[model samples]
Target chain A: MNLIPVKTRILQKNENLFLFFIEYAEKNINRVIQENSVLVISSKIVAVSQNRIMNILDIENKESVELFRKAVIDEADEILVDKNKFFLTVKNGVVIANAGIDKSNSKTGEIILWPENIQEFADIFSEKIKKKYALKNFGVVISDSRVTMRRRGTVGVALNWSGFWGVKDERGTKDLFGRKLEVSTVNIADNLVSAAEILMGQAAECIPFVIIQNLDSGLFTNIQQTHKSAEISQEEDLFQISSN
Target chain B: MNLIPVKTRILQKNENLFLFFIEYAEKNINRVIQENSVLVISSKIVAVSQNRIMNILDIENKESVELFRKAVIDEADEILVDKNKFFLTVKNGVVIANAGIDKSNSKTGEIILWPENIQEFADIFSEKIKKKYALKNFGVVISDSRVTMRRRGTVGVALNWSGFWGVKDERGTKDLFGRKLEVSTVNIADNLVSAAEILMGQAAECIPFVIIQNLDSGLFTNIQQTHKSAEISQEEDLFQISSN
Candidate 1:
């Protein structure tokens, strides 16, 4: 596999990211990426592009805001209020202050929710790329940098995916001695995004996109969808929590 | 990030793996890799190569096994007996049978302990790889498949590493908006290994060694030498006991 860092500019607060990518990939992406290659995009860029910014002032000093503030102060290690009413936090293994609220990047002062719809966005983006490039085995991954509550720093996770097999496994495949494997399925996108995130640094890498090639395209099933958050629970997480 | 699946046909139970890798990489590995690129090896293969297999027959019908059996039978979904001594659980997220005992893959039916010294072996492997290829920036990672007590499935954890940075970012770096990033440095190697293991399926895909390149070498640091296990108290673990 070849790791091609997508050389894109740092996203601004209210920039239109989808249009930017359409123009950039058309002009700048290398031709070497065959129909079988995969493109990985940071979820932060998607969130920013979709205008999912939230503002704290607009939250109103109501019961919800009061409760939220109390929770923030109690749970978060650090918090900051940007000029645009955007609250940021390095808490609970996440960087989005106010849990990904925004107002500066949205139209008007209202906060745009997490992409209005992430699955729709991923499908549209994937379709556009496939149609434009005439590629059959291409995939688009909308990734986010998240912190585990107890673990340090951020690792990339696939918020939504398209044009790829989400997982692969052989539940009954035999081992070397002919014993069958009970239940083993690989989360392909999550793994790939994590690998690529190593190159896409959090603060100052300027790389928002990564192209991974030479993957086993057969592992994909051409389904575009969003992963359920319910599958991951704080209670089941071991590395993040300290058993004091 | 190049994924080169090193193909080596090992005769069943043949313990020596280093020879197989050297031969396979020299022949099947592509030329695109720089001589200085690093080779990341999973820990299971290392254990297997070190002949760390355990059999059930060797373990006497002792009190420890009986006690562990009683304690785990209610919790374990399925129990597997191999060679009469080792008792492996299907999905308990714990790799050790009889609370981590056995001796199958060692000489004369003796349990070859978790690599006599992991870091030392890693260092030696790193030096050999660097010397053979005349490479300046290369590393070796020995990974193991471990199940955290409360989590689902088996995820690969870094057992030992050489010629690589284990973790990056210190506790006190500034965030994008100039706020101090307390406890933000990430465990780059462990996360990467976990991601890679997703593709290196437990039973199906026999690809042991994966080549990782184009990573920001600046983030690389010395491997973590400590083997301190996390102390999890029954009360502190939210999932340890159910009140319902």
Candidate 2:
């Protein structure tokens, strides 16, 4: 597997996503984008491109800090923790601090909300990428990082994906000894995102895109993708706390 | 980043981890070992090498079902959930189902315990690999995969690491707009492991090792590595559920 980070100048708000991609490919990765490659994109850039951004001072009747606080509450599906300095909220069926509203690396006094309808964005983006490159087997993943339970630093998570199966179902698969494996479905999208996140530094590095190559063509398909296969309902979650 | 999976025949119990590595390097990766590379290893192989195997029927006066149940309880620091088919336990300060005890991919009737003192093993393995290859800097990560909350498929986790700082701290770093980034530490070890996990396939794939090249040398350090550097105490944990 080859992971290549695409560095860019600071992305401007409402910039064209596909155009920026083309500019980068033409400038840096000319002729390198190939079939069976996966593109891992930072969701912040997509959100900015969608104009999913907020300015603290623009809201009425609240201080700057309170404005940020209100945004978290407004966007959160559920607020799990309300710490003095941090908010852990469930957004789009996943627990993300502040509903994945990124404040850093943006224009001062502005925050980028998690991109809306990310699945649609990824689906559209994949079409544009594949059409421009004339590639049949390609994948696109919109990604972000979150702190998992009982862990210190953040781990990558796929917000949405297209052009391939995000999770590889390994049910009924045999192990080395021909015995059925247990709970072995692999989350390929999150894995790819996490790999790309290392090169996409969280602070100050302007790399918002990553190109991954050397994938098994089996991972790609024209089948439409959905999150249902990768989601375990709250009632069925194995690690759910009853009170939650 | 270049990730090269080293496929091997099914590893045997009590095999020397370092010797097996030497054999693979001589046969396949004769001269590709270099400084600033990370070797992501599946913890199961390390546990097997350590002879951390147990037979379910060996315990006296207990049914096989009861013996497996007892093992889960004995190994867990705290068993958070006890279900008919699954056990969610906190082992070594992290939430892992069944205390990271793996049953699949093993000889029938045997289970592999999560290797004891993994940091020590990683440290020793790093030393042997570095000396053998005469590399100035290298890293070793003991890895596993787990299903995160609300997610269906498993994502990779680093149980322990050696020869580098696992978390790259960006505590006081400025963002693109010169604003201090928030909660911006990068978990490099987990990221690398997660990347390798995609190629390391959870079932039937005989690839137990992944060599990662093309890392920034600044990530390596002579400072001693410790879990404490990456751990957040229960008191300091932001995602804490007070009732627990």
Candidate 3:
């Protein structure tokens, strides 16, 4: 599969990402995304667009700030605390530090968290793009950078998705030798999002979005779109270990 | 990205996998891959083929067997000690088990360990296949099913590989916005082998091999084939916790 990284302007806090895409599309800025291509946006941008910002300073006490810092550390994997008050995870995974908190592109001193309603945001964005372009089979994936335990660095993971098949195949398909397979379906959307994240760097370039095309359309029939709560279980979650 | 499971007739003790492949590839095989293709073979077949068999009954005392068993457990993530004699661990990143033993595929009452010189075997098999098929860029990977510390079931991992690029791209290229990528290059051969292993299931079918093609060819230009010694470091290896 060919990976193309889209170059877009830095997203300002409180700015609607969908509106930004609509504006770009109207200006003929991103024509590479054809009628039925998929657009993958970072969850940070989605969260910013949805105004999901929480500031540690606004929290009443030092105890709460400390607890939140520990939670962010545990859930995010890698982190950097800046200026004694701002905690950022850098590419380490926690997008809370100054790296994640924005003042230049955001309201003053207001730390922006991820979008509140990511699934709804993805659905609305996908619907708007489809309606405006008259395109069928278009998709939108709200992604976030995450690090797996024992592995270093981060890879983009899908937080919410719409207009695409979330999973492909099912267990019990016959192998080439005719033996039935069990428990072998793949998470196609997650894999595609991971592939797309190769182009969305964490720092510097600020290309927080990507438009993917020429994907195998046959893999887009059984889409499973859900909110973050549905995808993350409190128990059996590795990220929750340090948080608690 | 389509996966096809391979099946082989049940192998007897002292069965040579290289010879087996030579005979198997001769019939029904359409093409012996020339470039950007990999062959996945079971490490058990390699050990049995190379005549690396042992017997626990031959040991003088229970203490010796117990010590060996403990070492196996310590080194491996999961331990399956059947009948208190035979041992197995599905896929846990490392390739050794029973401390790498075999009895079902070996002579009665005898257990086989992994091959002594797997890279040598791979080199020879690679040469033979190339000469026979008049091909240029194929690879042979001896794999074993292993289980991890916290994970369940068996996953295939490459024990040894030859005639193929071992690790693909190191992250040095800039993203579209000119941000330098760090630590992003992946072990492409290992991931591809793992992908193939999901299809090459154990039990019943006895599918010991698979052929993978259509991988990106750019990966081969800077091939980085590694040996077992390179995989382990005496200084930092935690599994060397106990002295044998």
Chain A TM-scores of each predicted structure, in the order given, are 0.68, 0.93, 0.71
Q: What is the lDDT of candidate 1?
A: 0.54
TM-score of each: 0.71, 0.95, 0.52
Give the interface RMSD of candidate 3. 9.6
Interface RMSD of each: 8.7, 1.5, 9.6
Name the runs in model 1 displaced over 4 angstroms: A26-28, A56-114, A148-153, A229-244, B11-14, B30-36, B57-116, B145-156, B170-183, B221-244
lDDT of each: 0.54, 0.84, 0.53
User: DockQ for each candidate?
Assistant: 0.21, 0.72, 0.08
Tens-digit lDDT string for candidate 1 (A64-142):
4654465455444445332222234533223444444322223332443445466677788778877877878888776
Stretches of candidate 2 above 4 Å error? A58-62, A242-244, B57-62, B242-244
The Cα RMSD across the true interface for model 1 is 8.7
TM-scores of chain B, in order: 0.67, 0.93, 0.73
In the range B159-229, model 1's lDDT, one tens digit per residue, is: 56667665566446543444343334455665567656755666635767877665566645444433222
Residue B147 in model 2: lDDT: 72
Q: What TM-score does prediction 2 earn? A: 0.95
Better of 1 and 2 by lDDT: 2
Task: Report the lDDT tens digits of candidate 3 across residue range B1-244.
Answer: 2233456776666676667776665563655455666677777667666666566552336865675565456445544333354444422334334555433344333545666677777777776776777767777777754432212233344666777655444456654335344334344444445545444544343667777665455544324365432243433222221222
- Judge the docking of candidate 1 as incorrect, acceptable, medium or high: incorrect
